[model samples]
Target: MRHIPNALCILRMLLVVPIAWLLTAGEYKATLWVFAFAGFTDGLDGFLAKRCGWMSELGKILDPLADKILLVSVFITLAVIGVVPVWLAATAVLRDVTITIGAITYNALYGYPHGNPTVISKINTLCQIVYLLLAVAAKAGEWAPDTALLILGAMVFVTTVVSGIDYVVTYTRKAIAASRAKHGLA
Candidate 1:
């Protein structure tokens, strides 16, 4: 039971290699289905972890790490394949960079982790999936899907930037509180 989350995380990581292979081979259709499966399993992992009381400290770290690495690598690969626009990929990846830095800084200063996913962050993730689907579909040379990809990319870009700011502010406050406590002033 306690291993469910780790299993899912490992599954997500394993899926990434094939995703990269599919993209490199220009198999967007296959990539679409596999990517969707990975997304579905990602959600299932967290739900089962909570429902089955399978959440461990390692799971706390591993689940999100798997998601980040898999999704980030996919976005980068798609950009390299010229299926997704470089700017859109940059926006999505930049938020990841900001969140990672903030997490590390918060841990250093506060001696604890400070966040789960914010609503905005979840919205960003959903938008990213939409963007990926659209981008992959666009590789089939359909204009309508390309339009949707453009819209989804814009939403992802906005949500990602918004969530990045939210995370930095949220975690910085916690770090500041910890600093004050260390000085006996909190």
Candidate 2:
């Protein structure tokens, strides 16, 4: 029972692969439903785990992995189909790669815990998702979807840079402070 949320997190990660395949196949209707289901299950597991005090470091780690995989895969699919700007996809992917590498490096070197997203990061994620959905919707020749995707893409770009920098800066400062405090230097 304690592992239930972790299991769901893994399931969500797996869901990304097939959902990307469906989206790439131009199955918007089906992809939409699958994406919705994935989101719902993710929410359900998180909610239940938090309420039951079953949340763990493991779940914290895996949940974000699932989210990144889904978002990156969506960007790739939409870009391949010419629904999204390739530069935007590149930025999204590069940011994820940068952060993941930084997290791994920080965890190994400074022994810092995995930090959850700040509110800015959360808003950035929503913008990214909206950008993806609008791009997917634009494939059917809707101008509104196209316009919204462009606007959201720009916002995603800005937010990505800001959030990524905020994390790195905060983590670096915290590490320094922790080291200083540990040595009676703070």
Best by TM-score, which number?
1
Encode model 1's per-residue lDDT on 1-186: one tens digit a residue: 679789989999999999899989988788888988888888899899999898888888888788788879999999898877788788778888888887887777666583688898888887887678667767755444555666777888889889888988887777787789989997
| Local accuracy of candidate 2 as per-residue lDDT tens digits, 1-186 | 889888888888888888888887888767776776777666777787899899988788888888788888888877787777788888888888888888887777667555878888888877887666566556544454445666787899999889888877877787787678878998
Clash count, one per candidate: 0, 0
Q: In terms of lDDT, which candidate is strongest? A: 1
Give the C-alpha miss distance for residue 54 in model 2, angstroms: 2.4
lDDT of 1: 0.82
State the C-alpha lDDT per candidate: 0.82, 0.79
Clashing pairs in 2: none
TM-score of each: 0.92, 0.86
Model 1 / residue 181 / CA error / Å: 0.8
What's model 1's lDDT at 75? 93
For candidate 2, the TM-score is 0.86
Question: What overall lDDT, based on C-alpha atoms, would model 2 receive against the true structure?
Answer: 0.79
